[model samples]
Target: SVCHANSIRAEQAETFVADRLKEIVQLPEVLPRLVAALNEEIVRQSQPLEQELVVLLERKEELKTKIEKWEAALEDSPELFPMLKDRLDELTEKRRQLHIRENEILGIFQQGEPIQVKDVQRILTSLDRFLAQSEKKQIKALYRTFIEKITFDPNHKEM
Candidate 1:
């Protein structure tokens, strides 16, 4: 009895599916060729993203090689040691300034004011100016310190 009931349900499901397919086939505006064309376009659009990823991977490899070469050069030059040290010190100072600015910005965000596009632009411009000035000062200091170190070194070879 159970097998007979299951067969009847299966027959009803097959009839329903056939009816739906017939309705779809009878539709006037649905074109299989257009659907296939749209699907092909979607596939074509996705292909460029794969190409972009490959380009990015190649760029990353190039940058890695450049960075490794720079590191090796720095290691081979003893004069670069003190210059790098000064640069690191300058970076630390700039980072401290940035931290203060970040905290101020966070406080502003916490104040619940509606930030407009102009406000964001103004803030970004101000930050850029401040960082540029700070970087200039840091570079000047670094150069001065490097020059002083070079002059003070007893064993320094004039180049």
Candidate 2:
């Protein structure tokens, strides 16, 4: 179950990374350091969740082993055995709850969709506003540089 949860979380994290990379296309300056920073953040957020799942699975296994030992010892004392059984039942319940939560979180991760068009439009609008506020000469130079990068086919209608 932990393995499954980790897998789902990884997928969600990758999707987030891809979305961010796509958004980077709009930025005028493509800083390698900024790209690396974003990648680091994605890994940082996902790694802790993966570690937590590993710990949960290990603890669950340990609890199961302890419960088995207690059960075996209880066969000798019927009265003492019931108390041990109750404790085991409590531990089992806790494990069950953990499993349910893990599965739910995993399901949410798997079901998550990419950011909507509205979100992209909002981001682009913000960027446009920022660019508009810059000096006209600078903006024109930037625009000309971008325009000069393309080669128009002579057969096509001239702009």
Estimate the lDDT of model 1: 0.48
Candidate 1 Cα misplacement greater than 4 A, ranges: 1-35, 78-159
| TM-score attained by model 1 | 0.30
Model 2 stretches astray by more than 4 angstroms = 1-39, 74-81, 104-159
Error of 2 at 53 (Å): 1.2
TM-scores for every predicted model: 0.30, 0.42
Report, for every candidate in turn, its global Cα lDDT versus the true structure: 0.48, 0.58
Mind giving the per-residue lDDT tens digits that candidate 2 earns over 108-128?
A: 556544344445556656645
* Pairs clashing within candidate 1: none
How many angstroms is residue 2 displaced in model 1 relative to the true structure, after the best TM-score fit?
58
lDDT of 1 by residue, 1-159 (tens): 111432434334333433433443445344354455655765676556556555655654655565556567678996786667655555455545545554554454455333343444454455445434676555345334423321212243211
Candidate 2, which ten residues in sequence have the lowest lDDT sum?
Answer: 1-10
Quick one: best lDDT, which candidate? 2
Residue 121 error, candidate 2, Å: 8.4
